[model samples]
Target: MNKLLKYLLATILAVSFINCTDNFEDINTDPNGISNQSLTQMNNHIGGSFTPMFLNVFNVTPAWNYQLQQGLLGDVYSGYMTPPTPFAGNVNNMTYALVDGWNGFPWSDAYGSVMPFVLDIKNAVELGNDPSGDKFVYLANIIKVSAMHRVSDIYGPIRYTKFDDFTTTGEYDSQETAYNAFFNDLGAAIDGLKSFESDSQFVPFDMSSLGGDIAMWRKYANSLRLRLAMRVVNVNPTLAKTQGEKSLSSDAGLLETQDMYINTGFAHPITVISGSWGDVRMGAEMESILEGFGDGREEKYFNPASDPALNGVFKGIRMGIEIEAKGQYGNHSSIGSVIDGETMQWMTAAEVHFLMAEAALRGWSGAGNVKAHYEAGIRTSFSQHSVSGVDAYLLDNTSTPKDFVDAINPINNIAYPSDVKIAYNNTGTNEEQLEQIITQKWIAMFPDGQEAWSEFRRTGYPRIYPVMINNSGGTIDTNIQIRRINFVSNEINTNSTNVNTAISYLNGPDNGGTRLWWDIPGSNF
Candidate 1:
């Protein structure tokens, strides 16, 4: 962490020096620069730094950055959306070739845009010696956990817990250590925010849909705690149960009424990728479940195909297939108007209901009826999208996912793997109910592929199709699929010693096939 921080600071200084003339006074006196005194006038330094952390969590700029951050990896792997373009001549992330060049964006975006701003807020509060500023620190920590958890989930070990300590070398926390830190940080944030529930200081600088409401922020934090709690249930059930009960009983409560969306004043990246560039389209798994169930949300999520051969049906491309050109599947469904707005959704109330449903299935205290929660998840998702016919949709026990048929290439088609139905079966086994909870959660989450991909790897629910092509040179298994992405090249190149130590923390070799700490290989029970 120290080395990376020094390198970033040095680069900034180098760029500033390059633009300077011979006059030191002229170079030092930039009229447009905001002074430290001015920053302290209204805590601009603390509040302004939060915007980047919010935006970079999903990255709403340049569009391609978001494409690499999650669209290319989780969006495809979660069976949500797949790119029509066969980048690198068909040797790319979809086929398990694992492009090092594109895979570094998630890592770099966090360290560059998120971590630095967090450190700035902490430093500003501490340097001012203002105990009243603790509210700002608490808010910053909540945002930090929200951002860094995604980074850790993607690459397993990341530079967290000791990021501010410049004395230590660039050491990385193993995924387990990082998760424990995430839990502790979230717990502390939830507690510290209770007194500031009425504080209105955050409103002017609030960029999220919460609108600087401290009460809502605390609720979001509690909901996030439950999410992280459920993520570790498979590997450490006792700890998971403890944390899950804590979040459920907390007075802060979870996100129950509305979704958490970051108002990143840019067009949704899906619009650019699927609508403008034609690089992305619906996934085969999405087609199977949505179309087969006759779900009303399908019309809100995607448009019918434009190709005359398919006759304007909602179609998608199978991942890891042989495609010589994009034109073959370019006419497949594009993203619909649901995400045409300026905000990027982070977490939803529907997701929290599904989480509660899973917690109840695990028999955690304070987790109410499982069937009720499951049904509420479906209703909440339909309500969020303003879709009708959820009553009929939830009762349909007969419809299962349909087999996928690639209209462009017949060889890429595959059968739907699971027979899981739409209706919740109370008499079914625990595993069966768990699958029902997760599969509905998957559909309710819609375009958030990062969390969806993580859930799929953790629970093995909502059976997705395996890749038709394997280009990993045996580093990845076709059946096991890609478990985790390898560490990026930037870390290996700049921080070789620490990156090597981080690789040893993984369960297997640091490749796409290696499982993270929470991705256990056995039954859900």
Candidate 2:
């Protein structure tokens, strides 16, 4: 009986040990840390994080963020759209008065919405030692370059390259250094993605119109590489040629037919322009250039002015106005429905073709010639807008940009700056040809005012209107106009030490008067 009692006790202890061993992992596991299973659920963490980054870059849902992110700044500065309402007692961005409160949106929105999500996937993929880690890391790198370039373009220097390290996280890279990093990042992405051409994991996670095809993304990246290469041609021609030729020579190809558009799952921000808000309207530049060319796309781009005094003509407001309320210029031509679609354009083939055209002019390899590339760009834009008679429009060498006529306030009207014709003139000087190319490119890139503003700063082609009132307090030159926005107050307040150090990177003051690294103040020729 003693032997039987010992055997029963041993059996009970063995059962108890088995139960503890079986439940150990479940009991010890923290619910907070993401499980490997959860990481693998959404195409290896790419879908969950990438979607928000892509969507919020444009900030489609909240109209006010878009207002500060673009409409009041780039749109106004680029000569694309101008707000009718004069907020802050009419002393605001439109009047060359930089609003610190409004100026912080682009930086805040980017760091808050876009970069965090990108960093998450980057960290996760690196830590997991996932077999597809290179593929995920490379793709995120492309998005990072694309998104951050805009930010750098906005404020000149930005928190890139060292953004991941908490110790040096707030350190800013000068625009030149940031651009070099961008090129390197893009190069890695192209090489890494080429190996994963058949990887179907990206398909479910894509928010772009390319349908998650790795090859398409590669092509888009190549096109983007060309765009960035062309951006630096004035400042760094050798680097520009090297990168441009690399993209031009790639079998992955450029954005030949399709424009890069992200479906934001929300309406385009232009709805705020044409809809009930009625805050924004066509710019004087748009009215003059479109009407001057007799371009058929004008009607598609804007409505006739509602001011009965103007007799239903397509009128536009000047950049700066001291209106008591929006009602003053609210009846001017609002933006058209073409920009009100679900997808937001990142880049277009028309703009790319013009880049190639400029490249050809610079004698870059693989860009056929100036004339062919120029005409192709115009034709592509015509087709994209569903406007016919491209042949006739291209033949019109007599039509120069018309002198702007402000029907409401004739004081704002100005004469055309250039006699540049529509036809591609091989006999013309290099400067003449460049102006023609950039002007058409500017028109093709309508409503994407941010890129247009950057191009305007770089090339100084397609002369934009000066602000009616110079409220910049002698900081911004009225003739030179606003070059780049001052680094936002958020950076000044939260990251004061780093922000102070960054001001040393600027060629001028840390104000709108300063030019960016790529925007060398001179003729491209």
Candidate 3:
């Protein structure tokens, strides 16, 4: 085992089996002193194996790891924040030039930290004597789907569906195949969990906001099923509708009043934005949209700029700018305390409402009409952030995205892309209704820019600004923006044949310009 796998095994032995369990620590003692026969009775490690899988997907501490895994990639591409640091002489990912070193973290973290642990849980459950272990198998599958979907979204294909087999573990699955596997995994997880709805074994190990309520986990699984279903709506409408309706009609419920968040022991990673690193500032789209609408959540989401020229105004950096130094845009508005809590938002009630709204627009059965779901989404978002004046905000239909004026660089200023309003546009066409649903969903799912970026690619709503710098050197079109990042060089170095096979699955060359399987290249309607 290499260092990462070694670290994982050590962590499982030290923390997962002992600290994460209810009373495994008190019972298991003197492993070295015990004879071989005594060790066979300790099946406690099986239950504890899930702790690392639950936590590593989001990654709690040593925040810089998360900076590489998500903050620098998804968050930036989602038009949430832009880095001021001119890393590698401004030819890094912020400028559309792929950073091989930086891009490896998201992949390595998933395969190394999440996948191996999930494999362990599955293997241990299969070997265990207790039939109740089936519940844990279901739970592990849910975690696997949650973690791996993000990985599959980032790269067009991934080493899923065959990860358990040594001979085929290195092979890749196309995005469509991966998504189908996800639906199947989540479907089986939900059905298996139903029999264990009253089982309390999960409560001791669950660190999410759901508190190990099996019914609520069922709900989250169903909601995630809905999310994945919508992801492929444009490419695979029949499958999308089939899976989506199953979720909507299920009595297991959805994440309506409650939000899904992970309770990591440390502070949220947004501290890396506002703190000494000063690496990230608000994105130009955020400044334009939030300031234009006079959205009250602006105060909740970001702090005013430190630049005296802007006079404490909310400013944001446009992505892919030619920066000589960090000081150029470092003083712009930093992300605020909204993400400083113990938990980070995964899925929210507001987002679910918006998903339903889109489903309604598509004429899906269980989702209500476009108007009600759209308005409910906004209201739920306002309530989630504890921002008031929603009634007035919702009534005002004239507000639209304002032009973004960069505080430091006037050359970077640009006009807003769309005039889509805040109020529900019932008279609008299906495309217009979709724009309304996805745009609000984007705002409500703040800070978790991975999902936001994915939805933006799918819908192209709330038009995002294109890159100011095209360091991709013709591999990526600056106007089209980056569609998906190329496979990290680490895979090429370690698993060259598999990586080559994966590239063959791409619609185009293995570059940022290539669209994934689900990202249809037309109007959403």
Candidate 1 per-residue lDDT over residues 1-525, each given as its tens digit:
553343344335333423432443454445687445554666665676777777789988889999999999999999999888989898899999999999999999998888877776787688779887888888988988998899999999998987889964379999999999999999998999899998898886677889999999999999999999999999999989999999999999999888999877678988998888999999999999999899899999999998888888999888999978888789999888788888899999999999999999989999999999999999999999999999998899999999999896788989998889999999999999999999999999989999999999999978878998899999888998899989999889989999999999999899999999999998988
TM-score: model 3 vs. ground truth? 0.93
lDDT of each candidate versus the true structure: 0.88, 0.82, 0.83
Residue 224 lDDT in candidate 3: 95
Model 1 ranges off by over 4 Å = 1-38
**Model 2: per-residue lDDT, tens digit, 15-55?**
33234444534643567864546545654344556665676
Please state every model's RMSD to the true fold in angstroms: 5.1, 10.5, 4.3
Looking at candidate 1, the ten consecutive residues that score lowest on lDDT are: 13-22
Backbone steric clashes in candidate 2, count: 0
lDDT value, residue 421 of candidate 3: 87
Span of 10 residues, lowest total lDDT, candidate 3: 35-44
Q: Worst lDDT window (10 residues) for model 2?
A: 9-18
Candidate 3: where is the Cα deviation over 4 Å?
1-11, 14-43
Per-structure clash totals for the candidates:
1, 0, 0
Which pairs of residues collide in model 3? none
Name the candidate, 2 or 3, with the larger lDDT value: 3
